[model samples]
Target chain A: DVKVTQSSRYLVKRTGEKVFLECVQDMDHENMFWYRQDPGLGLRLIYFSYDVKMKEKGDIPEGYSVSREKKERFSLILESASTNQTSMYLCASSPNRGGGNTDTQYFGPGTRLTVL
Target chain B: GQQVMQIPQYQHVQEGEDFTTYCNSSTTLSNIQWYKQRPGGHPVFLIQLVKSGEVKKQKRLTFQFGEAKKNSSLHITATQTTDVGTYFCAYGQNFVFGPGTRLSVLP
Candidate 1:
């Protein structure tokens, strides 16, 4: 079974504070993604990394950055946390099939971030 | 970027009742995937349909892909309390997910 673990399950931060959400996958998948889920908004992609040091912006990447220094780890950085940034953060990883076919994503336990 | 739309933003059903959710796309899709997210839990992959007009079933749940590959539906027969959660339909390689249909099954 694939295991994806996040650094924190729940986090609280103050406005303008720097926040980091970490995700690690044991499957060594080549594709990793960061998403923020809000009510009625579904899961919106924030950033994704296809390989080490390779990053791509998703639909909503503002105020957020990603780091993929290693294959197993992906980090989401909140430049300066704001109340509007509070949402459930999810990390997913999928193996590279090297084709146009879509791969199934395995998700980690989400981190619910609260910005006050 | 592709858009996937799901109907019945919310549904409440009593135990043993049937429930269904629909997902539609403006343009044809190569494949579609379904996911379930329990309350306070992250979304989990349920199933994927690649072939058009394909139907797959798991236990009492049925998933169907439209012949046009532009729509899909998930149906759950005899709902159980454990089935309460949000159902999402995703499309495209980027996995653009729908807003999701929240299901509440009352025992």
Candidate 2:
């Protein structure tokens, strides 16, 4: 089974602090994504990496960034934590796919962050 | 920009009752995927529909893709306590997801 794991299940941080959320997938997937889920807002993508060192900005990319240095690991970084940034963060990985393939995504247990 | 929307922001039903959620996309989709996220849990992929006017079933759940490829629906034959969760519809070339629907089942 494909296993996606996140570093933290819950976290609390002070404002202005730099934070790092790590995600690793055991399966050799080519695509990795980071999304933040807020009440009523749904899962808004922050960043996605299709390959090592390649990244793309999603709908809500501000206040967040991502790094994909290896095939199995993706990291989400918060340059400066703020109260408004508190929410549930999810990481997902999917195998490479062409048009029409299902390429279903496997998600990791989310990390709920609270910025004070 | 593509938009995906799900109706019935929230639904409450008794056990053994039927439940359904509808999803509409602004632009025709190449494919549509459905996901379920239980309370306090991450979302999990349920099914994906590709062909226009396609319908698929998984035990008690039925998924249908509209003929125009711009809408989809998921219907549960009988609501169970375990079926409680938020159902999300994802579309677009980039798999942009709809806001999702929260379902509550009363036993």
Candidate 3:
């Protein structure tokens, strides 16, 4: 089975503190994504990386950045965390861009970040 | 921007009853995918539909992609406690998920 693992299940940070949420996939997928889940708002994309050392901003990439130094790992970083940034952060990976038949997206358990 | 929306953000149903959720996209999608995320768990892929007006079934669940490839639906034949979760429909490149329908199955 494809496995996606996040570094932390729960994290708390003070305002203005830097935070990092790490995600690692064992399937060697080429695409990785980070999203924040909120009630009623749904899953909003924060950032995504298609290849190592490459990243792109997503719909809600205001205070978030991502890094992909290795094919199996993707990291989401918050330069200066704010209370509004508290959310359930999710990480996902797919074999490739779902252009043909890449429908499946394996996800990690998620990190619930509490920016106080 | 490619966007998708799901209707009836929350649904409450009794066990043994049926439930259905709808997803609509702003643009024509190449394909549509369905996913289920249990409470406090990550999302898991359920099924995918490619062709226009395509229909696929998995056990008690039925998934359909509209003829316009801009809408889709997921119907569960008989609701069960285990069926309680958020159902998400995504359509676009790299499988973008919608807001999701949170289903509460009451015993």
The order by descending lDDT is 1, 2, 3
Query: What docking grade does candidate 1 earn?
Result: high
For model 3, how does the per-residue alpha-carbon lDDT over A1-116 read when each residue is reduced to its tens digit? 99999999999999999999999999989989999999988788889888899998888899888889999999999999999999999999988744356647888999999999
Per-prediction backbone clash count: 0, 0, 0
Residues B11-37, candidate 2, lDDT per residue (tens digit)?
Answer: 999999999999998888889999999
Error of 1 at B37 (Å): 0.7
The root-mean-square deviation over C-alpha atoms between each candidate and the true structure, in angstroms, is 0.9, 1.0, 1.3
- Tell me the TM-score of chain B in each candidate: 0.97, 0.97, 0.96
Which ten-residue region of model 2 chain B has the weakest summed lDDT?
B89-98
Summarize candidate 2's per-residue lDDT along A32-100 as a digit string, tens digits.
Answer: 999999999999988998899999999998999889999999999999999999999999999887664
Q: For model 2, what is the error of residue B25's alpha carbon versus the real structure, in angstroms, after optimal superposition? A: 0.8
Model 3 chain A: lowest-lDDT 10 consecutive positions: A96-105
In candidate 1, list every pair of residues with a backbone clash.
none
The residue-by-residue lDDT of candidate 1 on B32-57, one tens digit each, is 99999999888899999999999999
Q: After superposition, how far is residue B34 of candidate 3 from its true place, in Å?
A: 0.6
Better of 1 and 2 by lDDT: 1
For each candidate, what's the DockQ? 0.90, 0.71, 0.71
Error of 1 at B48 (Å): 0.6
